[model samples]
Target: MRKILTPLLTILHRNTCFSVRLAAMALIATLPGATLAQGLFSPAITVNGDAITGYELEQRALLLRVLNAPGNTPELARKALIEDKLKLQAAKAAGIELTPEELKAGMDEFAGRANMSTDALLQALAQENISRQTLRDFVKVNLLWRNYVTARFGARARPTDAEVDRAMGRGGASGGIQVLLSEVIIPITPQTAAQVEALADRIAQVKGYDAFSAAATQYSASNSRADGGRLGWMPLTRLPAPLQSVILGLKKGEVTAPLALPNAVALFQMRGIRETGGSDPSYAKIDYASYLIPGGRSPEALATAQRIIDSTDTCDDLYGIAKDQPPQVLERNERAPRDIPRDVALELSKLDTDETSTALTRNNGQTLVLLMLCGRTAQSIAEASRDQIGNALIEQRLQSFSASQIEQLRADAQILER
Candidate 1:
């Protein structure tokens, strides 16, 4: 089966500068073992008869390496190029093409991320053997894909004002307490119900958030599994009345006993609880750390992650494990929830200080990601700017819709990887 590179696409879309850097590097990186001219046009992979050349793969790998994108760069490059081919094919089929002016504008927009003009970016790329045409082509495909997705999915993707308000925790007229929750939902069929129940019982006894998160990654069927079952902040009243009481009873850092549903077993972890005077009760800041594990989501890799989780209690404890690893392997930062990747943010939302999740993967599923929440700072609704809240809500919805669209595309396409 062809492995989808959806994660790589997510990374690239979230960090446009990283994609641009890859574009420049893909154009510049020299080929080995063959003459540059020959290698430049040689097929590395083909999607629906469209070839992604070896040169393109090399350039993407070089660029990903340069930007410190995690996992196996060459493999990631191959997958990324394959997906790009698919996107390009889809866009062409949909009659979506970027005009010359539109393409130029896209390039300018990309260059602006680094505070450079198109010519300046091109000059920089040329210094490293990349061509201006390469950058233009990169921008052109992305522009076309963006236009296509928006045109096709925009109505469905659009968030109602009430939906945005609910996301911002302002849907209700009356004030209420808000809680930060991390949730895992394990799906079950009639055949798996008993087995799932047993597993849920075991998860209930897991020692920490890290263990819970690992379980979620391995066994959960929810979209939140990508971030280890994190649900971020929402009003207490927003929850189902029965679950609200159960959640309110959980102490900070406590995971609930599995609550059986019609088709799934659900659990929640209480990261925090706070009261607010106004409608919004969202967090203002979050501090966390991510430690990269080499293998993706394989059982062996998961076992290794379990070991890491068992060996540590706090983000600081990870320092001992990271003693000889590259500095980039461990990252600690304080960011707004909106500034953090959606997956990571959700995981962090399910954690108390020092709790970790092993739910996310990187580099086309060649690496495991361990994310630990270090702290969260809450702001009163009065202090939180409406614009910031609204913008954040819109971005989150857009990200969810974009991911869904890509997944649907991959599902419907007849992709052949070489």
Candidate 2:
């Protein structure tokens, strides 16, 4: 694999820039000799009698590395190939096939994620010894599996109006509060701990929107820092329980004292708070868990998260998984939506109870957060209409069904690794 990379770059020299060529050259230099000695096209693994070649693994790993995907690249590549095999097999069994237009669109959409055209993405991959077929196969499997899942389970997953009411707490008490707030989340590290802490203290003391927004622009690591930490009107019930009272007690333009979080310090400024009518309901509490896996977004960490998902059924199951590890490695908390970190909360919002996401990182991407939604305690008014909630419920249910179906396929399949 490593030997061929130089020639691959030679071919790409005319098309890719000098910097990309240098990076690819440097990347090839780091490949272990032992791995390069293997027959590149020989089977490394087999799923349900379908072979996964060493060439496939290498190409996929290179693609992931180019995309800056977290976790052990090789391991993640292996896992992905195994899953792709299963997905394709299942899709075939279900008689699911993609139209050429759908295939082209899938490829286009995938390239767009990297802010590139399909041809450009292919050229980039070619620089790293990855062929166009690798990308095509990956996109095809995903599209087929998605179509299969939607077709198989779409109808049965829709929620009734009563279920939506229950989910929204529609008939419960009204007059809940809503707030407009700004936020600042400063990162803390061992080297810069003292400096960041001092800065956070000073930022907490800042008064008026301009002062706070300036501080956020200068020091906040949050994505909202670009917009001066400004957040839209959110219901009080959406805030973490620990922060709700503190925020409510603040007058306009006053900021809260610095609050400690996992490897970060958070400060919120109260822009406005007001009582809301019955139409806008909110949650009382959201139960969730975060299990930390070291090595940031490396492939090994991602593979471990997948194994954990296979073994665990709920948040409680994480306790047992982390029993002998450090206490901080696993955390289960019930808080308001606004209290969770924006990234984690965003992932949580899309998930149903017991469902997990590995999209969040902490400690400067030095750790991966295996986040799971334990449950939600609904109360107050409402947001989505019955039809919208029904659609959401259907999507959520489909995710669960898709996961289960894949698990079943994996269990039944004969998977062998060399």
Candidate 3:
């Protein structure tokens, strides 16, 4: 299954654990000679009085590998199995039990996430030497824990009107985070990789806007380098989703750790951040194009880019410049913000409609990228309602309770690794 990369590369991969089944299968199904590792049936771990067999540990580790879960697979498998055992124990103590219909529904639901029937899923797993019981047990514990949480915390987790309004950005007041940032992007070719990495790390530690701005002016490969890499105040929602957390975590004047991007490294200094009046708008789609040119960041490539910039007024104009080139050299796409590649989204955030940037490269720095923003389709918030927002808040609160409950169980239970 681990060799299944090529055929399944086009299938959508959901990052969350529950939704990754199809993607995981896609990853594992293509392996030509892969075989499961077997182990003795002695206990590998114990939670309270329940034993986790060595065979079960191996099964889970294989599953985690298929899912491409990060870190040591065996360790992660052990931790997860321990948590599941605790969760089931807590569910049992709370008198949670599923009917046959409910268990079937849970199995169907889990299989549905991968667009497979329960039988189909079981057959697929069987082909990989994973038992049907393993799938049933995994689904059973999750269902039990969910029922336990809902029964115990549902009533206490309801949100008030004010809380709902605040969450949905309709609090009848201007609210949402906005940030001012200074950036430094250093191109990293194999020849300059070590130097660029060291430079980026050093820049990350530079204190104050002036110092950071100086570094940007001296070394940044971005257009904003001329303005000391200063960006105007931007709504947090307008940034790439991954970058939002990094920005939120910074204090004014603190820099983010050097973020790796295609052919470059980026560092940002937080100039200022504040809660601004107004809802932070979401976009339904972003339309953009990228034209690849030969000779990355070389004098000729830069001159060509500048010439193209002067001649082109919109994304459509790029078609003329790339008229004779291979189709793959030029790309135009309209994607939901969440679906855009992180590096592309980051660059798009810094542009207005029809604006172009040459800040990115491709083909391992052998080609320069000419990127243009076509336009953004703003997502309508007309359907957002009090009830929808309130229910979401309640779910969040319940999840918090669920996490704490598990922690309490783990603390009170005797868990030992054999």
Candidate 4:
């Protein structure tokens, strides 16, 4: 869920049957409200007025487990549950509300999103072995919290005409398209319709796939968002056979129609193509240059960077800058596992120096002149793009707002977590 801020200290009352069941369990078990002791761990510690039983944590953790959540750990799961409880408590203080039907609707969407039938979803929940009532309580809190946010925060809900106008003017990516991609992998299962399509979706994102550019414009996490579906140049073999065929057949700039596969649909656009060469970290040795002007004159930095780009035909002048001013060069470097994020290293394998990349971009009061395609290798991957950074910032703000609101509620909360 996206982050949210409260105008009137609103809480999203997302109560679920889980909270109710926990309460019921507390009553039936005759334990302190904070005693979280359950079936796991040594024994649960009872918190303020609630029971932070091991049983309870395990029950909540099971929800995450059932979904095969990535990189999950017991402690992380515990922290997440604590955060959820905090949210629930906050919602209650603010008098948030949710109906059973709304909860069911939300559950249905969640279940469907995971590609599970309602019955299957239930069965999975049952495997958690937490009472069905427990699930309901969880749903209850979530709904209530959302309601509270909309209500108490309703006054602050105004997105405003000026904001809207600003968004419009600044929203569209002037140069590129942002892409979002969802993939259902077989996890190596034999090619079934669902499995095949899932892989298809994933494959389609590999540069030259039919749907690569189009769907990516909507799904990709990139700075080139305003452009419909465009990506930087890509090597031929980076894609599978089906995708490679479409890309190889393309002109310098062409849109490929959606290609049907065993299970997926693909659409794409060829933004550009360029030369690549032999290197360990292929992009580490870059040929592209940047326009770095000092921060004394902000616009000049940008202008000078652009001027370097506009005046010079190539990165030939990069050395001149290093000669004239204090300069730093960032080389594409390779590292083994533990040295870099696995995903980043993988992306780096596909790029090279001399190629134009939206990577290596930043403007922190200093002039930025990025040289393209400095070098390449099967090395470290880059971090998020400018657009990715923006989206992330938005999400972070929402969470921070929610956290602050929760803190205010905590002051009045008769809350305890073990």
Candidate 5:
């Protein structure tokens, strides 16, 4: 039978990036040469009908090294190889596949945690003498194993509407506590302290928070300065003690005077509030179609995105683009804000019937999303939100179910040591 080969994904470990597959390909080639001197390279174990050989084991070991196996730990390496082999076998058995986009997403996510761009990420590994092909293989195998588990056991993967309602009841959802606030930070260099303090004192005199916020935007040194120092809302518990007290003391349109700090004079204004279920639309769900671009976005990249936005206004047009981009489209049944990325949720909260949202976002250094809130339901409050009692029970069931699946995989596999 022919050897089964597939596209590889690089295994991006926390400490090191290793290529698992290109090394495997290299070994496959040199094994033919080595066999001239020795006998046949023996298979370590038989996976289904296929054999996993010592050469494959060594290659995977090279990829797994960043996991910090001890110096005398050939045994652990051997166990890892078997686990990997079985995982790939299980994935194929379960018919799980990773699309190129998912592979990219996984790669981008790994790179982001390391504070590197995807391209920079590949190069860093190459500098350490690891090939991109090897890294890709590592990522692909792990992803396969992950999908296999989920396909077999993820019916309990997500939360239901009723459960989200209960969370809202407990003030756990985004709007219930977190308030996105903008800030203008005036840096107080030793020389600038007096000037900044004077500015801070004047800021307190401004009548409305908006006037103060506008001035801060013009002069504050913080990142939120451009947006009028608007910090997204947060629970009081999350804030620094002093900052919390000031904001809590103010009302919807209030402004605070500049306060002193070691490094800066910070001024604050209350932009608005983050509210949960109330007298507004009783229940709503937004069906969104997204195009995920991974890696930190650049001005040029955003410019290109702005162009894409200018030309395509409808979801159908976005779909036309997705056909070529190999995009990911998910049609979630009426989702709560807590059920989705906070930014997307906030956008959904602002929509009117038959209306579309302005361009909005969800960002991790790796994942760049362009979301369109397609449709929503503003139903009667009588059935406002679903019953939380059953929903909470369902969530509990799902968690228990996932734990059981992980345990089963642990028990079912014949994981061996060297």
Candidate 6:
């Protein structure tokens, strides 16, 4: 009887211990914030068996919004995360991993963009419920991917001298003169003409390319505002007849007197001049059109522009998009490169016939100018700097290769959305 009772007590104690452990787990599941944490940290999507949690998506969207990135925040965040996963996987496969020190340095560099120290940035993010880990993760992936691409593809990404020369607009048999010019175009209406002229006069008085660049950033209406108004070497023949004498007359670091335009006043700062060998036809005239959209850089406006880009293969297709709008909305004209406005010419330089640029803005950022390249009539030109040409070619090739590699990675990835 004593043996039976002892065995029974031991069995009861073991059963009680198991019951207590199960009860505690059930209590934890029902507790405040516990279930919420589980849901937030749970996998939202799986890329090649690796999970991207809901919390990560929320953090990324918040980060993009803070950084003023364009487009839909959530959608963009999701897309970015998917790409990040792919990049990270590739980096791992290449045996390229970011060290802890390297990650901290990357975090520091990112904080510097906001003029803050790493600790300060972390504190600021914490106040907004963004974890420091989120920033670290973002920087880590970017740094690793960039390093990986350079290491893996840098050797094959170099551009030849001939490619660079052509990119620099020196690909023809005839040699020509090219001028390196910085420009500022201030849009003016009748009511604001006096103010525009006064501003232009002040800018002209300010000496040096740096001063001119500051003025361009503060006041220029062109899309090249972000570039400090620097227009890389353009053939002298590409400029308008009226502006040719003005640009050539100015000494280096000197600004042009205000030149009046139909809707704006223009100023040019001569940076330098050079002659290149091998004459490619300098464009004597360009035929193009401009269509205006109401919101300058808004997502909706950009989406519409993208739709137009996708639907239209040539400049003629733009006429349909402009149908039922104002007549001036689709203005077509043939003008020399210089007469086309420096910003417009810069955009045109990047495009082939029938291509379009959504780079320029007007009416002080309230309007988007869709510039369509209709055609270019080329004239004979001189040879350009082979070194400069080579550098430009190499840069372009690297960019193209980087993009192609990323697309290929995406194609090969096995992504599963949870």
Among all candidates shown, the one with the greatest lDDT: 3
- Per TM-score, what order, best first? 3, 1, 2, 6, 4, 5
lDDT of 5: 0.53
**The 10-residue segment with the lowest total lDDT in model 4:** 1-10
Tens-place lDDT digits, model 5, residues 42-102? 7656544456666555555554444333344455555445555666776777778889999
TM-score of each: 0.44, 0.43, 0.50, 0.36, 0.34, 0.43
Best by TM-score: 3
Q: Give lDDT tens digits, candidate 6, residues 66-91.
A: 44444455555666788788888989
lDDT of 4 by residue, 228-273 (tens): 3443444443344345565656664455554542212344455555
**Per-candidate RMSD vs. true structure?**
23.9, 23.5, 20.8, 21.9, 21.1, 24.7
The list of candidate 5 runs beyond 4 A from truth reads 1-41, 64-73, 117-119, 127-129, 160-418
User: For candidate 3, what's the RMSD?
Assistant: 20.8
Residues forming the 10-long window of minimal summed lDDT in candidate 1: 1-10
The alpha-carbon deviation from the true structure for residue 151 of candidate 2, after best TM-score superposition, in angstroms, is: 1.8
- Model 3 over residues 91-142: C-alpha lDDT tens digits? 8888899999999998987777677788977887777667888778887888
Compared with the true structure, what per-residue lDDT tens digits does model 2 show for residues 28-77? 55778766556566788999899998667766766555554545555556
lDDT for predicted candidate 3 compared with the true structure? 0.78
Q: Write the per-residue lDDT of candidate 1 for residues 1-418, one digit (tens) a residue.
A: 0022223344454523232233443444554535766766777566767787766765655445434566655555665666676678878889887777888788887777666677876776665555666667667777777787777766666666545434444323446688887777665556666898998998888877788788877877555788886677766754544666898899988999988654467778888998877664446566688899886667787888889989998778889999999999998898766677645654454555666766676675567778887665454443555566666665566667666766676677666654
What value does the lDDT take at residue 243 in candidate 1?
A: 69
In model 6, where do residues sit more than 4 Å from their true spots? 1-31, 170-395
Q: Which stretches of candidate 3 lie over 4 Å from their true place?
A: 1-175, 381-418
- Candidates 1 and 6 compared by TM-score, better number: 1
TM-score: model 4 vs. ground truth: 0.36
Runs with alpha carbons beyond 4 Å of true place in candidate 2: 1-38, 170-385
Preferred candidate (lDDT higher): 2 or 6: 2
- Point out where model 1 deviates above 4 Å: 1-36, 170-394
lDDT (Cα atoms) of all candidates against the true structure: 0.67, 0.73, 0.78, 0.44, 0.53, 0.70
Model 2 — which ten-residue stretch has the worst lDDT? 13-22
